[model samples]
Target: MRAAGFAPTTATYNVLIKAHCSDAAVPIDDAVRLFQNIAKPDVCSYNTVIDGLCRRGRLPEACDLFAEMIANGIAPTVVTYTTVIHWLAREACFDDALKLFDEMSGRGIMPNVVTYSSLIDGLCKGGRAASALELLDRMVRERKLPNTITYSSVIDGLCKEGRLGQAMEILDRMRLQGRKPDAGLFGKLITGLCDSGRALEAANYLDEMILAGIEPNRLTWSLHSKINDAVVKTLCAKGEVSRAFQVYQSMRTRGISTEPKTFHLLVECLSKKNYLEKAAHVVRDMLSERCIPERETWDTIVRAYWSKKKVRQEAEEMWSQLTVTN
Candidate 1:
């Protein structure tokens, strides 16, 4: 352009830099070269360069450019502050991001919804769901209603942290506000319920999703399996062997294949209750399917025999056979 009698201003370079910075598929070196080519760089140029570096995960270089901008008496815009905050958030550096946010405000830069949303997301993602909730309260007190995405993100985080009740409360609030959860948010809720041993509630939620005309995807199916496994394990742990066995059998009728872990857990549970005969039969079934019995399997049977004062010799013989065959 310069050779074609067209002069490129600092703003032109800044625009080019910003464009390159936002393109995830673009190389960072290209943005850096464009910024370097700018002569007599202004605030926009510096902001563009700093944002570009941060976007490329070059935080140190971004900081250096920020410092240089200040040295040159260039005031940063909201976009510049946003770039730094987003970068820090992405790195899980919430403290630094919050400090930068405060500094931006101290410099009289008012944050928009995007800034607040990003900070809230960072806090939630960093496992600070409590803090995120507090921040959301603050936002509400200041008359800023949360968007659906913000609500969903915080709900997902709370659910993942085992605060299923709190997450449900949020979901209820969302519904009252006439906002519905998308598939992803529904998946998270189901997963959280299952993780908390609320398999029945998880199943109910799945039914609710169906009633709402939402089809369960692979993720929902995976959560169903997890919830079923947890229920079976809990039943077994409570010495409800017959119930666990019934649930295991019902899985096949539901088209859910019996996983290896399910067999292991059930066998171990039966053995613990002095049902070595039943445990051995289960082990035989496992081996019949070419699933080699784990050491824990042998140990369970041995302990079962020892518990009943039956025969350590038989236990030893079984152990020897397991070692040779397995």
Candidate 2:
């Protein structure tokens, strides 16, 4: 274009420099050379080369270019600071990142959500969750709301540190502010609870989670099933068959499918305890869900119902429906 008498504008030059920085075949040195040859290289020129150098793990060189940019009176933007902060965080160089963030702020570059997010995430990953929480408070004071990743990182750190009560508080606070919990968040809470031997608390949250209209993913569903089964087995073994039946019914209504063995054990226990109709309902529910009870399960249910003369016809009808459905 220059040979054709069309001089490249500064914007055109910036574009060319960015193109060179992005091309792996063209080393960042080429882009730097091009930047130096330009009559005036703007902040974008500095940012492009710094980012390219950071991508290739040339942080020392990138910092040198940053210094040169500052010495040349080209002030760095939030993007400039964020790129370096994020890279430094990922590389486990938190002290330098923090100093750079402070310097950027001193230069009147207000950190954006991306900047705070990087700092918070990096702090949490560096085992400074308390500091991350402090930063989150500062973010709120600055009227900069933390997003999901921000909250999840802190919650995860709390859980890993076994500060579950505090974690639950944060979870509730997020809910009060209308940031609905996702399946991943609930899964983390549930796993943490189970690990702490507070599975019954996990069960309560599972119920609340489904009621809140969040569908559990595959892993969450599996954990939920395990917790519910534990509850049912505990109730049955304690001779609280009525309560156990109620839990069983709740599981069915929630579309939580348990194994045939769970139903069989519950029905057999209920029959021995003279809860004939509840036993019949359990068998009926099993057949409806295509979880066919074994022959012995059927025999116990039928014999228990036959012993109750008045409820015999209803039991026989339920049995007939079960057979036809199966």
Candidate 3:
């Protein structure tokens, strides 16, 4: 356009700057040069360049340009404040980020959901979940509905802080607001509950997760297996053999592999309960899955069967069959 004798306007330069900033192969310095050449830079021009600087991890330069924009009688827009606050939060400059947040609010600029979400995420990552929750409350009071990312960050932070009860309340609130919790979110809650020795509650959440139809995808499969294994093992240790067996069945039905320790626990607990037939079936499954049951597990099953007067003959025949199969 310039070669065709048409001078590029500020809008045209702004577009070029944004393009250059977004493309990793293009040097940010080139975008800065183009921005510098804009004769009458507007709010859009400043926002574009500031965002570019932040994206390139040049926060100090971005802040300086921000101040320059304000000093030149060009009022900063919501985008301007949000961009700076987001980067400040990302760089773990929570004090600066919060100061900018208050500054924008004091200037009568209302923050949007993205602004709140960014700050919430940053605060959560910095282990300030309680503070993040306060922001979430204030955000609701200001009538800004929290999105999935907002809720997720708060819940994850709460879980990390071992404030699981609050996390659960947030999850319930999220659901009431019609936001369906994903597997990762549920995994966080379940892991937290399990770590706190609340396996029973964790198992209940796992059931709720399944009932909610949140199937584990490739990304969450490992987490699914891990939580299930933990719940089953803990249940067995707590002598809730019946519940453990139910969970084991659920894992198998879902095609989730049970860990060897979990399988062993189920077999041992079932034998103790004198459920000889079920115990033998689990041992058979162990063999089928190439999970060799420990010798103690075999002894438990054999002893349970032999100790039962009603199933003595069946025990002998079953033992022969198992030995042959193995």
Identify the candidate with maximal lDDT: 3
Q: Is candidate 1 or candidate 3 better by TM-score?
A: 3
Cα lDDT, all candidates = 0.77, 0.82, 0.90
Worst 10 residues of 2 by lDDT: 194-203
Instruction: Put the candidates in TM-score order, highest first.
Output: 3, 2, 1
**Total clashing pairs in model 2:** 0
Report the lDDT of model 2 for residue 189: 75
Q: TM-scores, in order shown?
A: 0.64, 0.67, 0.86
Per-residue lDDT tens digits for candidate 3, residues 91-163, read 9999999999999999999999999999999999899998899999999999999998899999999999999
TM-score for model 3?
A: 0.86
RMSD of each: 7.9, 7.6, 4.4
Which ranges of candidate 3 are over 4 A from the true structure?
Answer: 268-276, 294-326
lDDT of 1 by residue, 79-131 (tens): 78877787888789888888898898899987766777888888889999998
- Assess candidate 1 and give its TM-score to the true structure: 0.64
